[model samples]
Target: MIIFRPPKYDAIDHEKNLKESDGLKFATEIYKGQRSLSAIVEFVLSRIKNYVKKLHNFDQINKYIQGRTKTNKSKILLLTDKNKPTPLIKSIAIDYLSSFETAYITIKKNEKDEIFDFFKIDKDIAKLPQIIIIDTKDNPNEKEEIIVYDGDLNKVALSHYLSNFATPLEGPASKRMDLLNKHKNINNSQNNKKDKNKKKKNSKNTANAHDEL
Candidate 1:
């Protein structure tokens, strides 16, 4: 499982700072193909810098901390294959970021075996499109609490499960305003139709009264 940690700054040297961290060690292990666990570790490590950069830019990191504080829960990390098409996963991640201010990392397929071995994943369990939610707070010796699920992108159950960790935002302010305006236009059109109908009815009643007179 990927571990999400807050970024630390060391003015002395940026490369050295990242290299000395646990994230680097994990990246190195994956780079070295620890026990030949994953073939894509090198790719993951190479691209890790970009991931870190993006994470640094993420505004939800603070919310991630707040969520942990309020719920007494650990930060979340995601494990998934790099090669698999992840439109659903991407959507869920976006929603999580928008709602809860938390984002997760995706581990490529090559690293899956090692994770499975370490976590003692059952042999009968299917591998691809799997999500492993881990709570990494508290004592180091304590067994990590994990929840595993089949990675079915179309499943509402999986989406709901992820929703617990983050709230989905409607999008940018401009987009929201556009939606509001569109709704208003629709309401106005309906109201106009109703008014026209009322006028027609009144005119018919006046005509009938005149005929009777």
Candidate 2:
């Protein structure tokens, strides 16, 4: 059976460096070729053209949906159920969604700040995306946020920014929990064995003392 090994710290560092180098190359490519307003406009137009062309195939949309299948890709933020979402919280959530090209939100049936609450304001968002609110009670107070993007240009964003959050841990967090559980089981087993041995020893001593008497 093949086992998967996570990337080492050095490997992660190298990967980051490579990404930075690639970003610099892209910046250089744009800046080097006519660093004028017209050039910038032309670049933007080219990107739009590419985007429109890709929409016909719908590959990007499908890929984004598939990538978001997991909760991690969902990028949730769990929080305690509160009476209401503060103005500050609403602004922050909206701001995060604005950073993306498209954004959607699903609210529980009785959520304080349902999607209807934000529909009027969504027009102000440059993306002018759709928001969906699902009414599932089992999810209860769990809040979730999903952000999708290849890099800086966000493609899709979805959030169920409830008064709560939920996610399965990986990396160090998962490892620590596993170790704690293992230690607990081992300690319980050892204690049971020690108790058994102690009883056996005591029984042998009692028998020997009785024989001597």
Candidate 3:
């Protein structure tokens, strides 16, 4: 499993701004065959900055933060199971930002599948700071079900994430939307059949009453 935890950022951390010269250099360094986790993390952070620079515009920023304006900053915790793709978090962030500067992403991986045994740790992490948990694939802790919950309703949660980020060619959301609509139509047809049966019963009762008269 993957988890992201953001520190309770205060004014002090923000104020001690490092000079541009002293910035993290992992982005500039090309990856060798073997690399460290810290190096990869640094690269991700740099990528975040570069991504924001490209799409930075006031109108876009305003649209991104319209509902989230109350908090000057927000933390994004992206968790994915080991089996799922790792790049989903970056794509989702890019979709939301397009180029906003108020969010950060941290990633953690739990390879041992121990989260089930230590349920309290999971709860504590959730409570400590704002976070999001994503469960993918067959984990021992999860039951076999057609649907799962992640704080909000989502008939096609994965599709929503991909739709908002994935390019038009990929069209993850569009395909999912079609499937959802199809499901609804089927449900409506069943409901209509039930309604017709009820009407037929009412008609039979009325005819019997008239015959008695």
Q: Could you give candidate 2's per-residue lDDT for residues 74-161 as a string of tens digits?
A: 2212121333333322333333321222222223345323332432323233231232222222343554333312122221122223
Best by lDDT: 1
For candidate 1, write residues 1-213 as lDDT tens digits: 343333533422546676777654332222334445354544443332222111221234334333433334343444444433244544444434323222343444565565566546764665654555655446655655656655564635665565554434432223454688799999999999999999999999999999999
- TM-score ranking of the models: 1, 2, 3
Which stretches in model 2 have alpha-carbon errors above 4 Å? 1-72, 77-173
Q: Which 10 residues in a row give candidate 3 its minimum summed lDDT?
A: 128-137
Worst 10 residues of 1 by lDDT: 49-58
Candidates in order: C-alpha RMSD to true structure? 15.1, 18.8, 19.2
Candidate 1 regions exceeding 4 Å error are: 1-78, 98-112, 136-144, 170-213
lDDT for each residue of candidate 3 in 1-213, tens digit (9 for 90 to 100): 122323222222334334433443332434452267877775555343222211123343224333232223232333233322234444444433321222222223442134322322344334311223222223444432211124422323543643432322222345555677899999999999999999999999999999999
State in Å the error of residue 57, model 1.
Answer: 23
State which candidate, 1 or 3, has the greater lDDT: 1
Assess every candidate by TM-score: 0.36, 0.29, 0.25
